[model samples]
Target: MTLDLVNYEQKAHEAVKSFWSNREVAKQKQLLTGKADHGERAGVTAGKNMDGFLALVLDIIQANGLAHAEIHQNRSMLTLPGYFRPTKLWDLLVIYKGELIAAIELKSQVGSFGNNFNNRTEEAIGTAYDLWTAYREEAFGKQPRPFVGWLMMVEDAPKSRCAVRDASPHFPVFGEFEGASYLMRYDLLCQKLVKEQLYTTAALITSTRCAAETGEFSEMSSMTGFRPFVTALAGHVAAAAARLD
Candidate 1:
């Protein structure tokens, strides 16, 4: 059966819009009313606002016909054993009768692009290695290799769109990266993640605070577009369903 992609992009955009809107409202309501101290990080709990995006992904998975699979998103159940580490909590996980099916990680950044881009990249690469290595060690038991995916959302702003200067100090960076912006870097990152087989598919999406409410967003490349990401995921889910009761 063909996957229903009608308005999928807009739906994903709405999820992100809800996330940002909640964060802003929570911060303003607390700070402006003087109910919370400015030094206390009033909106600190807003980090989990991204759960909306997670839910949207789960919906897509279920719609693709794996609704009976043992899917997990709760913090406790999300933790899976790794070869390099004892355990790692993923954003989403799926299993069928104890057989590993798929795992996905979702991440987003609104500011401090320079300080966080490298960190995010490192974590993503490391997580994939750790999971696959663990699978190699039979951490999740004997089953076909599980599908892994990565999705990232970045705020569309001037700072993130401006090209960054690279300092190789020893060897010049790759030609394609010489004058790439953070968006381009992320696009390359997602594309390479799939190219290198680190993740089954990776998607990169961007939206601005002002345009987010209207469910407006843009894709950097077809490689990282939502359609490709969801299409790959649906295929994986369908395969896993054959093993389900």
Candidate 2:
């Protein structure tokens, strides 16, 4: 069956625009209140900059045939049992007929690229490991494997685009990462996440702060682009709907 992608390209453009504009608005609000955070944190402390992307994903789920699926986005309802911990909160969760359908995480990085990049990578990998191990332990009950997705948006700036060198004290680092920029590293991370079956799919996107008005964004590679991410999600949701029929 053909999958409906919900015209994600145009929607994604608008999402990007919203992301930038929201950040600016949050930063300005904090400043006006005389409680601004240092650096980019002022912009992200509101924690709603990624909501537009979340909406886009929700549209994909509904358009593909999961309109009846119970989607949880509230802070209290987004937690799932973890194998190593008590619980882990995801950005979004979908359930239907007492079965988990999907769990998604949306993240972004604006500055502090060096430290933040490593942190984001470790968090992504660890989150997937915890969730899948919990699945194996029957945390969500016996059911088909659910769709797991990770999507990241990073600021497209010279700091993120310039080549970065890693220090190898004992052994050499991977050749692919010899001089790769942070953006390239993110693309590689997303590709490896899918290649190793860690997640159903991962995507990377970049947008400038000025994109607040133009809604401009760029993808590092087709493999980790928004199109493939939404396509995989639509197919999964449609298949899940078919099974419920």
Please, what is the whole-model Cα lDDT of each candidate in the order they appear? 0.83, 0.95
Estimate, for each residue in 1-245, the C-alpha lDDT of model 2 and write its tens digit: 98988888899999999999889999999999999999989999899999989999999999988998999999999999999998999999999999999999999999899979989999999999999999999999999999999999999999999999989999999999999999999999999999988899999999988899989999999999999999999999999999996
TM-score of each: 0.91, 0.99
**Top candidate, metric lDDT:** 2
For model 2 the TM-score comes to 0.99
Off by over 4 Å in 2: none
Error of 1 at 27 (Å): 2.0
How well does candidate 1 match the true structure in TM-score terms? 0.91
Spell out the clash pairs found in candidate 1: none
